[model samples]
Each structure stands twice: as structure tokens, then as C-alpha cells.
Target: MSNFINKLWGSKSKASKTVTFGDSSFVNAPGGRIWTFISIATLILLWVLSSIFEWVKPIYWPPIQDVWSQFLVISSEGFRNSTLLEHVAASVGRVLAGFLLGCLIGIPLGFALALSKTMNRIFDPIVEFLRPMPPLALIPLVILWLGIGESAKIFLLFLASVWILALAARSGAMSTNLSKVHAAYTLNASKRQILFHVILPNALPEIFTGMRVAIGVCWGTVVAAELVAAESGLGMMVMVASKFLSTDIVVLGVILISLIAYVIDIFMRYLERRFVPWRGKAKH
Candidate 1:
């Protein structure tokens, strides 16, 4: 009887091992895809139900179908005699131009402040005073100086983005490991060599983080700038829709802005992963 019991237990163990290691296709099932589909379907259902129930009335909450129709109409008919493609191009051009300009100035200035004590002392107080003021608050001055054209809008965007980016770069530079700097010096490395090989690489992660934050801030400022004075772009579309009580068009504009921001954030994450592989591994 003991022999028979041992045989039964041995057979059970063998079966378990087979299930664990042999032909286990179930372990590779696409759970992520399933969850994504379910989540999207649930959201659509909820949106449809909300619209059917007249839940957000008086304030002009449009249904998903209406928003889709509005999007189609805009795609077909255009806004302010400008095609959707044209508006998108204009907005994207402004953002890239302004963001690039901010980076060019902010990065070098930040590095200077970080490396030079004299410069830091001279500029830090002035920067601190200016940093607290919102970019939107300076719109009047921006308009007065640059006028109500593309120049003013881009200027506002640059102002909104530059300070945050500069501060980030300075912080990154300051926070670079002192031991690494000392080690580079001991190894007969020049100051430029130390900065390029030791400081910049170590501070790269922080710089990327700063860029992400700056991108979001820039996006918000773009919308605000367009709202204040613009004949085209997503913000202008929303403003026009609001004036005419076109809730569907307004919703479409809001969704498009959100979608664009989301896409940009995804691209930023890709960049972070590609450039900061060490940081990614450490996170896991």
C-alpha cells in the first residue's frame, strides 16, 4: 500500500511539472490587449449612456456622435477658411519654433549659472523674481512689444517654457556627483573633458525630465496664447465654437488638444527610454 501511495504522488508531481513547463501557450496569452479593448469599450459605453441620459445639459455637453460629426465637418469644411491640416501645421510650427528657441537660450545660460559662482550670484535673484510670474500675466506686455501676431504668441510660449527648462538644467548640473568630478580631475582630465564626459552624461536624465515638464507647459501656453488672439489653430476653433454655442465643435477641439498632448508625452517617454537606458534598468 505504501508503494502504491508513493507511485500516485510521483505521478501527480510529474503532471504538475508538465503543466508548468510543457506546451504552456496559456501563459503567453495577450492579457494587455484584452484589457485595453475592454477599457476602451467601457469608456465608450459610459459616454453613450451619459449623453442618452441628458446628464450634462444647460452647459452644452455634446454626445460622442455629435463630436465625431463635428470633427468630420471641420475636416471637410475647415475653420476660418483654413483647412484642419493648415491649422495643425500652423500650431505645430509655432510650438516647435518657440520650444527650440527656448532650449537654445536656456540650456547655455543654465550651464553658465551652474558652473560659475559669480554668474549664479548675479542672476539667481533676478531669475527668482521673474520665475514666479505666470507667462499669461505677461501677455499684455508681450502684445505691446511684439504686437498681436504670430510673434507675440511664440514669444509668450518661449517665456513660459524657458524658465522651467533653465532651472531644471541648473539643478541637474549642480546635483552631478562631486566624487565623479574629483575623480576626473585626478585622472588629468581637462575641465571641458570632465564636463562633457562626467557631468553631462550624469545630468542627462534630469535634463530629459525637465524637457518633459517644459513640453507640457508649452502646450498649455500655446492654447492660452491662441485663445487670446488667433484666427486659426485648435484654441481658435474652440473659441469660435463657444461663441456660436457649438458644443460639438468645442468638444472635438478639446479632444484633439488632449490627443496631441498625449502623443507628445508618448514620444518623450520613448526618448527617455532610448537615451537613459541605465535609468530605465534601475527603475525596474
Candidate 2:
């Protein structure tokens, strides 16, 4: 038993090599960085040129300058009785609230499912059933039950994220190596220590992956819900602007949402790296 534990720890220490992106290596390469810049610049150049040359009507595709001017106006003069920042804040708040709540409930439920056969047998069917249903399709029912208040919107966002997170957690926990658990046992580690140190750590990477995906879904769900009925939000801004054919405001709202989502994903990646630096390093 002592020899086996030593062998396990030695192997783990030797396997401390960092993971690399392989095919996606260019993402961090200097040449790849240049290409990214060029790609974005080309699109911006085309947008500007299109406006100057009138390639597409302003109604269909507004000039970048027009969009910027509208942004300044909305930033100061306000849009639909609320400033641009307020709308953004409203949307972001709903997403964070619902997503955090989903994580709190879903992660434990997932761990329970992975650890207990009874929990799996009971909840697996319900999770699978709900997974296929579209969050948008639930709007009518959500409104019926929760009404068109903030609760309704938050509940919709919650539904969008919870199932995905639950599954991610279960997969992560189930994927923990039995050999590692046995090694812990051989070292006289208690079950609680093994669960916390071995199983939970092993499960973190999948949970982070699920979080990235769930956040994106929550953003989409909240926006769609706001479009249905909300006094404030980026989606509401877009919907209200469309009613008056205020294309620039609509474009601005979309750009803001996309930019925020991108930033959030970057943040999630940073957290994943910070918490699970050993992820992908362990040899099977």
C-alpha cells in the first residue's frame, strides 16, 4: 500500500507538464494576433466605405459614424427615457442574478446525482425532459405563473442555465478517477477528505466549462424575455427602437450585448485558469 501511494504521487509530480492549445496555438501567436487585428479592421473599413459610397442604404446598414453619434446622444440625452448605461445595467443584473442562483442550486444537485444512484434515478429523467424545451417557448407559461415582472425574466434566465450546469457537474464528478480515490484510501484519508481534495478538484474544469456556456445562454434568454415585456433593458431598448425604425439605437444595443458577452467569456476563461491550473495536465 505504501509503495502504491508513493508511485501514484511520483507519477503525478512527473506529469506536471502544462497543456498547450495545439491546433488553436495561433490564438496566442504574434502572427495570429496580427491576423485578428486585420480581420476586424477590414470589417470596420468596409462599414465605413459602405457608408461613404452608399453601397447599402443607411436604413438597412447605418454608417459607423452615425452609430457613434447616436451612441453619444443616447449616452447623454437618454433613450426611451433611460440612459444607455441603465439599460445595459438592467440586462447585466438580471443575467448575474439568475446565473448565480442556477449555479448554487445546480452544482450541488449535480454532485448529488453523481454520488447517489437514487438521486440519479429520480432527477435524470426530469432534467432530460426539460433540457429539450426552449426557454422562449416557456415565455407564455412563465408569464402565466410568474407574471411579466423581474421574477419572470430572472426565472426564464434561470431555466436557461440550470440544466446545462447540472449536467456539467454530474459529468465532472463521475469522471473522477477511481484509481485516485483508491490511492487516497490507501493513504488513510477519510471519505470527506477524498471527496473534497480528489473528487471536487477533478470536477472543477467541467463546471467552469458549463458556467461559460450557461452564462451565454442566460444572456440570450434574458434579452428575449425583455423583448416580450420589460420597461428597461438592452433588449427592450432594441425592441422599442425598432418600433420607430431607429436603426442606429438598435444596432448600438446589439453591439453592446455582443461586446459584454465576449468580455464575460474572457473573464470566465481567466477564472478557469486560476482555479484549475492542473486541468488537462493529468495523464490517463
Best by TM-score: 2
Q: Rate the local accuracy (lDDT) of all candidates.
A: 0.78, 0.86
RMSD of each: 9.4, 9.3
lDDT of 2 by residue, 1-284 (tens): 76555543332345444764455533422322445567889999999999889898878878888899999998998887889889899999999988998999899889988988999999889888998899989999999999889999988888899998999999999999899999999998998998899988999999999999999998777768796589899989888888888888888888999899999998998898789987776778
**lDDT of the structure predicted as candidate 2:** 0.86
Best by lDDT: 2
In angstroms, the error of model 2 at 206 is 1.0
**Clashes (candidate 2):** 0
Clash totals for all candidate models? 0, 0
Q: Give the TM-score of candidate 1.
A: 0.83
Cα error, residue 171 of model 2, in Å, equals: 1.2
Clashing pairs in 1: none
